[model samples]
Target chain A: MSDQTYVTSDPRGSITQLATPSRLEYFFTAGTSLSKNLRGYQRGQFIGQRCPVCSKVYVPSRGSCPVDGVALTEEVELKNTGTVTTFCVVNVPFAGQSIKIPYIAGQILLDGANLSFMGLIQECELEEVRMGMRVEAVWVDKEDLVPSLASVKYFRPTGEPDAAYETYQEYL
Target chain B: MSESPEIFTSPHVLEFPYSRSTGPVIGSFLTALRDGVLIGIKGTGGKVIFPPTEYDPDTAEETSGIVNVGPGAVVTSWGWVNQPLKQHPLQHPFAWALIQPDGADTAMLHVVDAGSESAMATGMRVTAIFRPADERIGAMADLIAFVPEEAK
Candidate 1:
């Protein structure tokens, strides 16, 4: 494809610049741990793996613990409910972004999982998204389920009292 | 608990998702390629550098002056692809070569359509074959591939 070029006047000579566009596509395998996690999502379950050395459970584990550098061999079933450990309001937009502008992207610490994962927080005003806010996964219809994170729509406030900071401080 | 299933595989697009600015020096070189001309920049030690850069690779001094170079080049080394990937420039078997244009001190990487691996060799001369004028868009893809000079 052709690049977009711009010529601007300058003291010495006209300056020339171009925006080069490129793309690539390939197959990505969701190895052992993640394959189980995604398949669990299809069944409306949240499956995580526990590292034997550290005992930290990771949702969508990439087969091993990042800190311990050992295989995560134990599978733990976790609840969709979690606490918003930290979050940011996304006001800027970019290409291929699916959520509307001004949405909340949050780090969620799921119940029974030792680590947190990012998820979209919705069904509340931007100012209402807090570090300890309780949230839960809102899944798509069962018939529409897929073996991917997309099976869960956005997470929303569970209306429960905010989780105490002491409960999720380690995640932050 | 049931045994874990086989690992899942899905199509993925590893995209750069961004465009980069080709500054003045590279902009000029690509612009010329779009115009059906191959060019080089004068570098340190009186060497011509193809696919010109802003600075000489050896001395790091800013490059100066432009000169028309090959349509003609010589293959310095090459690797043969028995089966091409989806992203490969050519669909059939081809050789990825380190080619030095007639007067260039540095070699540029490009593909050679030598028809068969048997036809490829070190020191073989090749010439650039450009895409049609209208199809060019100020990029390296403007030069489609090189072919053996004897067959040109």
Candidate 2:
């Protein structure tokens, strides 16, 4: 890359800054869609869609089915509980991370859902948590409620036996 | 007027659309914030964090617990932006700080009211300057910006 630089604020200053686009916008005129029918899970409800061709279930549904590549319809609710497939410890800090260092971010497969989602693990020591561990959802206070994914706070172990690897192998 | 020699250069442009999927859980939290509320997700350990996160950054499990964090926050770490960039919130010199509101375990990045580097400190206090109700948008800017608390 060329390292050409230009002055940002001061016209007479010798320091030069990189020239780049200041703003950007997108227009999806070609018709975009969601993979599954989304629902407000914090309100104690489940949501997803079923593909007409393969009859597969998808939560937070997409616009089209990955199997047959056809539009999916028929919304369905899923259970909030699920299993942890894999995870990582965020020991290193980065920009925009609000929480303290040495936190854990993991992927969870909600009950009755085919896909896994990422979330935080809390309420127990990092060492106490394990793979294939059973966890449950914790909702935010009602006063601070929103329609986004931050609704569920973090997952805590239920002290139940780790799920059998065969049960969630496909999720991995 | 006499013609001047012109410099020729290729204008390189970079752009990308971030398709953020606000899953059902976080989607509701953002929706609530848009309606004028500060929310946090309660981790299984009972610690609360602002800017409600989808999963516990520590365990990688799904989070369903929620909590109301604050109408105010504390300055945790800070830096002076004497030289402003185009994307920065303010065109004038300002301080960028991490504010941890009461009851929340994490800190949020924001601008502070210290006019000069000397006025701002790591432990100083500040509060949210909510945007006018009519101008509210579903983003951090919706909080407008944070300013230093007036000397009592």
Candidate 3:
């Protein structure tokens, strides 16, 4: 066993704590539009952007279309039920986390949306959460409504038929 | 084998805030510390915590008490920093340690005057070194650094 310890003394009879200034950051302006679309998801609605050139749809659209690098237009509504593409178990606890440890965080692709979004999976055991498992969005109380991601609580299994690996393989 | 890649870069700007919401108990303790008084929060476990915290570590309950901790403390753990960072208290090499002040159950962090690692050791007794009265601020820098007590 190690017997070593560490210590320091305040020059004054007692120490006075210091406060440092906070830092600021700025990202691309496209983030603003993306944020608005995310807010719509909180209202139990699905939305995405349609690429003008290739017609490929982008959920949580970006300023520049990925394939053609062109700006996307025409907002579209998507189905709520989707297939789980990939997932991981959050076994470790963090400082401000509300949910207990050993919860699952997963990525899901809605039925009509071209892209997938990440969310938590609950109402099932850690071992039971699998790829291609059907899941649906769970919402928070109406009083807790906010223009934030936490609006939809988590996705629970819908007990729909499991999707084949080849069906949604490209989304993986 | 393929040629090894080489990369070059200058110092990058990095920034973030250490956002902390001090609970009522800690806020009061900081208020007291700013007034130049050492105060400790007595915990349910009978341990008196200096630089008092809002929640008791053992019981996780709000703690209370305004016990004066020290005019001095002993160095418990220490490290010599020869190359100081931009935000460090001192630009020169100094010792950083967890100090257990007189009448305090928990230790507080601060710097010391020990010039080198060879000169600092666990259990080495030290005393608070205060700044000039006019320069005193409500921060740990008010105590410039802990100095070794003179040998009797």
- Output the number of the DockQ-best candidate: 1
lDDT of 3 by residue, B6-58 (tens): 21112334465364644455545544445555667777766888777766788
Q: Write the per-residue lDDT of candidate 1 for residues A108-148, one digit (tens) a residue.
A: 99998888988999899999999999999999999998888
Interface RMSD of each: 7.0, 21.0, 12.1
| Candidate with the larger DockQ of 1 and 2 | 1
The TM-score measured for candidate 1 stands at 0.79
Q: Pick the candidate with the highest TM-score.
A: 1
lDDT per residue for candidate 2 within A3-94, as digits (tens), equals 11211232232311222224444332212223112225435455677788878777656567887999876676777678889988889876
Looking at model 1, residue B111 earns an lDDT score of 96
TM-score of each: 0.79, 0.45, 0.49
- DockQ class, candidate 2: incorrect
Model 3, stretches more than 4 Å misplaced?
A1-32, B1-140, B143-152
Off by over 4 Å in 2: A1-39, B1-152
Q: Kindly report the docking quality category of candidate 3.
A: incorrect
lDDT of 3 by residue, A16-73 (tens): 3335646544332325446546656557666678888988777777656888988776
Q: How well is each residue in B1-152 modelled by candidate 1, as lDDT tens digits?
A: 12335778887766654566777678877777777677788878768888788788889977887777888999999999999988789999999999888878778999999999999999999999999977877778888899999998
lDDT to native, each model? 0.85, 0.66, 0.71
